[model samples]
Target: MSKLIIPLAIGAALLGAPAIPLPSGAGGGALQARELPAYLQCVPYAREVSGVRIFGDAHTWWSQASSRYERGNRPRVGAVMAFRPHRKMKLGHVAAVSKVIDSRTVLLDHANWSPINGRRGQIERDVKAIDVSPGNDWSEVRVWYAPLQALGKTRWPVHGFIYGDGAPAARPRVVSPPTHVAVTRAPSRQFASAFDAIRGGASPAGYRQAKPLPPQRGYRQAKPLVPQQQESQRKSQGQRTGAQARDPIAQVLARYD
Candidate 1:
């Protein structure tokens, strides 16, 4: 068999032993490739053992069209693929199935993978692949087996593969709320209130009121004389002068008048 399949055979043998429970957070929704056990609470351990850079959460692994896992989705050869988020764990998780040694065993590559409080980056650990049922239900599954040397320097209870507890029927898909839409509505109200405050001190349209001009200087009124009245005054003055001319003394008196 291929080198990849050998580890799987070893993992299958351990399946008969007592099962080890996965960390509480795994198993809720569809798994994605990048979302393997790394990048979550398990990241610190995965980096130490795998000697690879792991960043971002599992959501990065999703390919919108195909529900099935693909290498194009993750790019890395041995990278684990995670499923979509679920109600139980907001982030979904999965592992990269590296090698299939036999019907009962497969080589699993996963980071930050271990029992509760276990070390990370346990590379290419041997896991048993039991075909308990033909369908894709999570419950009809077998446990994975990890060797002591593969676990690096860290030592804990040496247990065999632990079968996963089957998930509930009718698994629910997790949907994140639309945050961008909510923010758009809030800015409209806040803008209107700001405009109203600015208008209060000036015009309702938010323009400064022009100051009233200083009171006009007092107006001087002159007597109004008709054109005919002005002409009559000139004739009367000429007649008086003519009568004064007839009498020398009267003329002098009239001139004085």
Candidate 2:
């Protein structure tokens, strides 16, 4: 009977028949493999943990938060650290700040950064990330690697941080009032001198010259000579000069006359 049963079981296994019950441990590995957690990406994990609500690729998070969320270079807890595409990381990376150890060090919770069990898209919790930028502005960083069990040697570029709050409102611009000046026009006066008037241009029709100032105290007023009086005085002076030339006694004779 035992020999008959053994032959029957062998025939069942060869023909691919399931007539016999298998052990409880049989195919356990395949079942566990099928039940493994699905691979996760950095973007969704960052959004979920940080509550930044950003979408699309990791590099675009900084720009997308410009108007919607507050962003800066300083790292804060619950903020998403946006990584710029560098080296072989073509699509870039994003991670949530679990803790800020100091000015230059931080702990990050992200996915797909380091592979586990010979597969990618694994989640890493509270991994160390150090700021390597010269200015200490968090512009560059080096993240912990699972394979090396240490911080990676590569200096990855970063795009700053995106906070979980809405952006502040813009301030209104102030304008100054226009200035006013007081201009006084000088009173119009007649030309002070004829030469000045001529240089300025020919006087307009009906233009009159300025009046002279009245004589002041202690000043003598002289009478102007007429044209005829001036000619008579010149003739008399010339006759006296001719008489002197004709006679040597003309000086005495002029005094007697």
- Would you estimate the TM-scores of all the predictions? 0.26, 0.50
The ten-residue window of minimal lDDT in model 2 covers: 29-38
Candidate 2 lDDT, tens digit per residue, 1-257? 33445655665555433353445555642221112234677888888888888898887888888888887888878888899999788888999999886666789999999998888888999998887776778898878899988878788999988889654322223255668856586435553454466788866446776789999999989888899999999999999888677552333223322
* Candidate 1 global TM-score: 0.26
Clashes of each: 15, 0
The alpha-carbon lDDT assigned to residue 205 of candidate 1 equals 46
Write down the lDDT that model 1 would get. Answer: 0.39
